[model samples]
Target: DTAVSQTPKYLVTQMGNDKSIKCEQNLGHDTMYWYKQDSKKFLKIMFSYNNKELIINETVPNRFSPKSPDKAHLNLHINSLELGDSAVYFCASSLRHTGELFFGEGSRLTVL
Candidate 1:
């Protein structure tokens, strides 16, 4: 069984388009998060949710949103996607806030 899974592994779109990525984890963890990796391969956490409640949000632009329907799933939505949003988005889960994270395969987005 996959510990973490994300759908729409690849996405290509023009600027101003909106898109969403879905994630699901079977690790039985209480914490899940979304991270964005820039063109330079720098990863930054965008949101963290614990037991369906958001706990951390890194000053991400309003265009980026993270939604957790339950402990095992977290979905990300990007509105008016911009060129700067072109990068790999990763979904991760941890047993706790400071525990080791289990990452999904990642969803790569490209904006033209």
Candidate 2:
């Protein structure tokens, strides 16, 4: 069984469209994170939620939002998507504030 899973593994949409990627973790971890891998394959942390609380918010745009309805779920919503948003978005979870992270396969978003 996958420890972390995300929906819509492949998404292709036009620019300015709004999209959401749902993520869930069965590891019972308290901390979840959203990372963006750009076209260059450089990974950057977008957001982090610990026990359903926002703990880390990186220098991401306001158009990107991370919603955690519970400790085991973290969803990412992007508004007015741009070409720059075309990349792989990964959902990850950790036991606590740190340590090994179990990551989903990644949701590849393509904004044309």
Candidate 3:
């Protein structure tokens, strides 16, 4: 049983399009997060939610939105995709603030 899973490990689309990535965790954790890893392998936190409550909202683009229906799931939606948006999106979860995070395999988004 996977602790966390994301759909469409690879996604390729042109600019101006919209796409959504789904993520789910079975660990029953109370916190979930979305992270973006650029081509340089720099990982940055995007959004974090705990028990369906938005806890951390980073200075991300308005075109990117994160939705958490429950503590175990968080989905990402992007509008008007751009070339700069091409990166690997990772979903993560942690039991507590000081706990080590468990990450998904990541979804690669390629915007042409």
Q: lDDT per residue, candidate 3, 1-112, as tens digits?
A: 9589998899999999999999999987889999999999999999999999999999999999889877888999999999999999999998866578999999999999
Ranking by lDDT: 2, 3, 1
Model 2 C-alpha lDDT per residue in residues 1-112, reported as the tens digit of each score: 8589999899999999999999999998999999999989999999999999999999999999999999999999999999989999999999884679999999999999
In Å, residue 101's CA in model 1 sits off its true spot by 0.2
Which stretches in model 3 have alpha-carbon errors above 4 Å?
none
Alpha-carbon shift of residue 50 in model 2 (angstroms) = 0.3
Q: Write the per-residue lDDT of candidate 1 for residues 1-112, one digit (tens) a residue.
A: 8589998999999999999999999989999999999988999999999999999999999998888888999999999989888999999999875779999999999999
What lDDT does candidate 2 reach at residue 79? 99
Q: How accurate is candidate 2 locally (lDDT)?
A: 0.95
What TM-score does each of the candidates earn? 0.96, 0.97, 0.96
